[model samples]
Target chain A: MRAHAQLIFWAVLVAALALLPPVVGVLHEPFYVELVRRVMIFAIAAASLNLILGYGGLVSFGHAAYLGIGGYAVGILSFYGMNSGWLQWPVAIGASALVALAIGAVSIRASGMYFIMITLAFTQMLYYLGISIEEFGGDDGMRIKTRSQFSGLIDLADPVASYYLVLVLMFGTIYLVHRIARSRFGMVLRAAKSNEARSRAIGFSPYSYRLCAFTIAGALCGLAGALLANHTAYITPDFMHWTRSGEIMFMVILGGVASSAGPLLGALVLLVFETLLAGWTEHWQVILGPLLVLSVIFFRTGLAGIIPGAGDE
Target chain B: MPPLTLVFEQLLNGVQFGVMLFLMAAGLTLVFGIMNFVNLAHGSFYMIGAYLTLAAVQWSGNYIAGVVLGLAGTLLVGMLVEVVALRTLYARDHLDHVLATFGLILFFNELVAIIWGRTLLDFPRPEWLRGHVEIFAGSRYPFYRAVVILVGLAVGAGLWYVVTRTRLGMLIRAGASNRTMIAALGVNVRLLYTVVFGFGCALAGLAGLMAGPIYAVLPGMGEMILIQVFVVIVIGGLGSIRGAFVGALLVGIVDTLGRAFLRPLLATMISPTAADSAGPALASMLIYLLMALVLAVRPEGLFPSRGR
Candidate 1:
């Protein structure tokens, strides 16, 4: 009975989202599509974060570094006059994966607060480096004159097309994360998160599992960054800022960590709230601050847990 | 060139910067130590302090009065944040603390933007601190800088005295050691936590007020210094007051000197063009390298708490 209810909820959610474009068309609202696209991008970022933070229990305060690297991959390649999708995407993902490996090599040795600080420091180093690079426009950021072309396979210049592409990626990522979470490797990672010593006792090397998870998460976030750079046709140091990383964590928590769909829901809710509240008042954060505090204080289970079918899963 | 004057000036700057960092790290380490809370919003208090000082100075037309009022204002806000927001987080996990404080940072940054326009506000040093003082032959340093150094020293001495020499200090230390025992002794742990939080905020505010004339007063100013303070606390060992003091000094000196001399030093070893390109990048990373080295050698930091 619970499984059936869960199935029904997911079907309803998908149907509702599919019907959104037409509903907005009826209301003469053109910005709704863009908002959805933005939400999808953040959802991807949040999902990547969830792999390490929610599942692996690695509170990396520097996830934005991957995003920045990914974005810069696209930005720098384009600046050097490379506009091929195949080349840019691979380079972006590869660069971010490499960075994750380097940072994770040293940082994964430390647990808890030390891990958090080390991640933060490494990301800040990247942030400052980005700012010091005069060729990349330094603090001002660089403008991508055009999106990466995929040789007639993908036309990213069209917003609707781009939006659909992002949605597909987001869906694929969600499905992939769900599958990974149920796998043997995922079991090891989860065990490590719950108790490292016990996992070690059980003959699992927690470090390698975590590093792999962290690397994979970084690669995924890097993909999101590439998409984001294309979406905006620009990249800046702000892309990798620690605060941006914090926001991704916020989305994960708001939606309920350790759940497949939570990050997506959290991203949507947060983006919508930000848009609505900003429209209503200049001091939207005043409202957000207390709301967040209350959420942490009272709603430890998060919004996903409030859903009748999703609670305690 | 007189070596004594150069050494003296650098030492003074190092001490001053160190003290400011200590003020920032003290609050952070205490919160982390006592409540096991990772409050990233601590920097926001420093930013608020600077903003409040700007407002008060403009309103009251007295810099000294503005500083005092700013400190009080930030303290109030800090206590209110602890009671209204951070209080509930004590029972929660570290992830929750990170999320809540992150939200607070975003909220505060936006609030400051709305209250004060995004443009940088000009903070004028008062007339009394505008002159230069000759500390040695052929060298003159800004009196304001000296004042800052003196103020930092005075505050450090005061903090040491309060923490080591008073009943409240004993309570604070005791709270860090064992919160349940302190509470079991019939002490109001809640009030103590609030006071400690408030006191930490005031120290951040004091740093901000002092920094107003030295640095640009703008939105998101807290961010630049926030990570440095984290490094200080980490190097000093989390939750140790002496650790914070020494770590702050070490970081300040390393960072300041690295920025000032790295390029020149590198030029001798590498090509000038390479040195020019790598100088700032490497300078920025010096403290982080120091942190990693410290972690590698002494993971508990130089002056970590004696026991778990």
Candidate 2:
């Protein structure tokens, strides 16, 4: 019964998010529409990270690399005068998938802290590469002259349309992730996460499962990245920095690791805190830093843990 | 103008950079080896050291006094942090340690920015250390760099002696090799952790002081160098000082030499424009490439500690 209430609570929250832009429009808070859009984009990113980080128990410190790759896909394509969303979005997803596959191939061989450092190094490599691409505006980054042209099917140029598109995609991603997590493959991944030896003894090789998850996560985040570039109409190497990865990781942990929908809550809370806190003080991280520390030290289950019996299992 | 002279001078520069890395990596490795704790905020200590040194220098009107006070301050601060924040994290998972320390890093970066402002602080080379010295074949080496290398080597030698000879060093090695065994022997492991952490902070501070004259003393400086330090520790072999020394020197030389020479070499082979972009890009990636190669060949590092 409590589980049903928790589920209803989550449904209500997601519904409120869906209704947010209209509500904000009524309040003349156009700024919040942009903020909510940003939150939804990152919600996709964080949820993608959850597949590998929370479910697979792989702490990939270079997840931001996918964001950069995806964003750059759109940015670079648009720079070359191609703005077709159909073309750019898939390219972003494909490029990120390939990179994730390659990085995962090597990184998966190493476990524990080595895996963390290796993933970070790979992202730094990409970051430096981004800076060296003089043709693409290099370290300064590039502005999108126009949003990804959808050939007038939906007109992404319309803010309301773009907002609803992002909102819908985010909902789809969360639903898809929930289904995957309950599937047989996700169970194997979870099994691998808890005890690799036991899983191996049972003849389910965790390696391929993990690699598949990593690739999917990367592709999803890449999609988010493409949206992000359109949403902001700019892309920079700064997007791929390891600290951004840290922020995403913080969202996963802050909301509740290994729990479906936790990353959404995490993303929502973090974005709200950042926006509200930064408005008050330039040294907002001074407050944020301690909050993260205190949370880790005290609330091992994250924000979701606050829900009675939610992550108690 | 002579290629030989350029190589010779750049080699010395590499060694200087290597020495600086060793100071940072040694402390990092020692803490990791002895405590099995990952401290992402180690770089924050490096930043603190540099800022404190700069502040002290400005206040005291004397470089030597500033160095002394800064080192002392960093040591004290490191111990205080360990006692206050890190001790609670000892029993937690590695992820928890990473998250908490990362938080510490954010806190320190913000605090420093608030206190000192975000702009880079000017750290001028002292008068006696400003000029270049004539070396092999009349090649010129900066006096400051040469001094840095000398001091680094001296410290490395001292660390070697202490680790291989002293009772405290013996305890540290023992702790790394087997923590429970040492605790079983009734050693005050907690106090030892504090001492080791403090010593590591001092070494990081020393590196910061040396680095201040070369790089801007500013917020987030520690983070910039911390990646390289992590590379050093990983390449060297966690919990092994010898590994850190070799790894630091190798990374230092390779990085400097690659940046200095790779572009020119590439230009000779490929088209100038191709070389122009590819050279610096590849050069920047050299250390990470080297690390990848090492990990691929030996995941435990070049010299992982024994009997873990």
Candidate 3:
């Protein structure tokens, strides 16, 4: 919780992520590169979710829909041979933003469990939409023939290039969230979350602030989704499932909420734990499930709280 | 147009589906209303109930007996989960409840898979219950489905009497309205909550067992209907029993009817090929769209609980 502690935490995490590739090269564990790339991509998503869910107090259970939408944006485009990142990535972000606009416009009016369920309903709606589209293989999903292209500046097909790309984006997202959390906009959003009536009395419309936060989070998560598609080179309706959203939410909570670096650490720990557990046994969920329950019960401060300092971000 | 008899059959199917949903939603709403706790794992009870029935029926060779034992087992499991994992979570944030219950879901699912070998299990209907019955001058219906309807209606009636007329029901209503105040009075709110939770689990188990004969019973079966049940509770009003029933029936009927008629309806307006493709997609999305529409008009639901 200390300021310097968080600084050190982010610094170490960035360096470690930045330096994972060569280490993988030395260890001859090429699979780990892909695994950590996934972790970083989701780290971007979890951090974005923390932006709304932690900082603004909006529990949008359908966050994964943006992932699906973003993935599909790149996917459906690539299906038509538009593998260019310039077109695909912006379309991914924009489409997700537009969908978020529609969903948030309707569901943000309600708060608490209603908000949660409504968001879930909307996401499931999109999941069905994804299912009904047969051209891209519907529920079976589609394989990405090529990762997004960058007009010769970069190639997502290259593993190291993709790794660094994800790393840069993840760090940017976390820093952007940290900045937003300290801004005037974040103060109003947090105020509305803590006391809606008081914030409204103070003339800050909670609706607009929360909607803005929700859409921004959705757009950011969409980028993560785009990366997720590139990382896996496949897109499926499964990406939009409510449980996937729950997993992302878990990353935010497991990492710690309202902290700049919490989502990054959380994604790293959870996915790594999963990888290790899966390697250990076929019934890895048996252990992971109870562990999640116990952690939610006991780990109020999350992995971030384990640090010596306990008060900062 | 479809034959009138086919329409009748679909109507009956819709009601049967509605009846099962009511059973699942009833317990959820009671717990949701009274404890203000959201149990995402409620569907686990349904799954366990179905698995228990499959195992018990095989062991006992009696359908009714298997169902009874399964319900009892589900009740016990519900109590154990309530005491061991959930009691402490009552005072925590809903997010904590979501996380914890979600964990329970994962644990129970894998545990069930471990025990049952992860293959889909089927529960056979009793020989007598599998016959068809003439319900009207020309209409014949499946007896098992009729039985499901009867059981659901009977339970709904019993629930109505209990909540409206009985002393325990009075206490449940009081606890739902003011848990602290009920505790302040001589009532042991804790025992009441466990009882409600267990009873709710039993209802869910009953629904699950009955559904086993109708749908494929599998480890994660609970979650498939669990979302629909949540939609029912949401549309009916979170804590209100009347709302749960109405909402359940509405969702069930709309879903069934939509799947049945949407293709024909769309075909009449568009190309048959387009309708064929679009129908299934629209059908799957029907209930969710209904929920969205309901929320748009009445954000608190049709029968919002008082004293929330």
Candidate 4:
């Protein structure tokens, strides 16, 4: 039954995507393609967060800082006339990883609110730094004149091509996370989340495993940030703001933590709600706030948590 | 031009800023320490306080009345939030608290924007407190700012007295130390929590009310101070009242002085252009850098919870 469900899920996903473009073409409404692309981008970020929050039991309030780092990587490099994919991608990932490692080292030692506060402070530091960089446009932000070039393979300047590229990366990330979750390393992570003392008794340092998970999550979110900069063709200090981090965490909760595909569903619900509600009224957040409160009250498992056969193994 | 006068002026500014931060941080620490709830929406209460103060001042035709109404309004809202949303989250994890409070932040910001409009509101200092008073032979400070410092010090003393000398304060301290034990003692834990929450809200509201005249009464003003408040609580030592007071003063002084003096100091050492470039950026981060240093040396904070 599980196998059948998986097969059906994959089939539906493929069929929907394959038919979506043509359907939109028939209707002469292709804007949703861009929306779907956005959903995918946010999903990548949410999923990365899930790896730490859900499996590793680390709730970081500052995950969006990595997204900012990733975006800044692209923006700063491009500003300096180094727009090659090889140079840009590695530098972005490396910078994000270094930050994650340093922050995670000190932060992982503190549990609960202390950890949350530390992460928040570090992220705010980044936000202020971003604002202070007068050359990078400070609070105003920097506009990318052109997207990264990938030596004759990917033309990121083309919207459709960039959308497909993001989609591919999204799929690749999902697959990688899935494999890691099912592996021995993932077993220790889950164990640590469930019972740190027991995991310690088993001779696994929970801190190291958690740190590894956090770094990996940061790297993935950074990649999403890079894609996001490409998507908007602009990067701002707002990307790294604490509020952005809150929004991503909202996505994680709305989708149901610990469940695969939860973040994607949550991102879709939030973005679509945001778009539709904003269209209806300028005070869309008022509606959203109460709705979110109700959702948390009623659906502890989130939107994905309600679906049949959606529980995590 | 005298160093003594310069130092005195900076000290006064530091104390004023510190008191404001204490108003914000005190509530945050109390809620977290007593209830074990990590409320990201505490800042929203501060925002509400500012907005309410603005409205109250307009309606009452007096700034003092506005201040009272603002405090009362925030207390009411805080209690309502506790009874409605936060009570359910008590049994849940910190993640739930973080997310729900985040939702509240979004909700409150939008609600304020809807009611007050997007443009920033001017919270006028009362005519009585508008002028400056001379503190030293040559230096003068705003009378309103002096009032803020005095009020903050008074509140801090009152808070200290209540926490240390009163029955409710004993209950709060006890609750923080051990909720289960306190619950077992037949105290109405829920009611206690609500009262504590309301008290914290009132403190935040007071901060907001006082801040209105000094800072722009805007939709997201609370957000700017929220992180700084967090840093103060962290440095003071989570769940420690004495820590919050000391921490607030430390952070406020360091931040204000850093911004005021770092550029000049750097200019004296380095080239003017370099100092000009690096000064503001470094000034902005000085408090956070101090926090990181504090956390590094003392992971639990300057004054951690006793026993565990």
- Top candidate when judged by TM-score against the true structure: 3
Q: Candidate 4 lDDT, tens digit per residue, B186-283?
A: 99999999999998988988898888888888888888898999899889888888899999999999998988889988998999999988999999
Query: Which segments of model 1 are wrong by more than 4 Å?
Result: A15-28, A308-313, B1-11
TM-score of chain A of 3: 0.97
Q: Compared with the true structure, what per-residue lDDT tens digits does model 4 show for residues A52-144?
A: 988888999999999999999999999999999888888888889889988898889888898898899889989998998798999999999
Candidate 2 chain A: 10-residue stretch with minimal lDDT? A304-313
Predicted model 2 interface RMSD: 1.2
Best of the candidates, DockQ:
4
Q: Which residue pairs show backbone clashes in model 2?
A: none
Give the alpha carbon lDDT tens digit for every residue of A1-313 in model 1: 8878778877787777677777887998879988998899889999988888888999999999988999999999999999998999999989999989888877888778878888998899899989887778889999999799999887998877788799889988977887787799999999999999999998999989999999999999999999999988999999989988877888888888888788888999999998999899877887887687678777778777888565325
- Candidate 2 residue spans exceeding 4 A from truth: A308-313
Give, for candidate 3 chain A, the lowest lDDT window spanning 10 residues.
Answer: A304-313
In candidate 1, what are the lDDT values of residues B1-308, reduced to their tens digit? Answer: 33667767776777778888988998888777777778889889989999998899899999899998999999999999998888978887777887788778877988899889889989999888899999877889889988888888788889889889999989988888889999999999999999999999899988988889988898789878989998887788888888998999999999887877788789999999989878988888889889888887887789878655
Task: Tell me chain A's TM-score in each of the predictions.
Answer: 0.96, 0.96, 0.97, 0.96
Query: Candidate 4: misplaced stretches above 4 Å?
Result: B1-4
- What tens-digit string does per-residue lDDT give for candidate 3 at B120-223? 87568889898899988798999999999999999999999999899999999998888889898989898999999999998999999999999988888998
TM-score of each: 0.94, 0.97, 0.98, 0.97
In candidate 3, what are the lDDT values of residues A1-313, reduced to their tens digit? 4668756765676788889899999999989899999999999999999999999999888899999999999999999999899999999999999999889998898878878878877787889889887988898999999889998998888999989998899888987988888899999989998899999998989998888888899899999999999988999999999889889999999888887767877888999999999999988888988898999888898877786542344
> After TM-score superposition, what is the CA distance of residue A303 in candidate 1 from its true location, in Å?
2.2
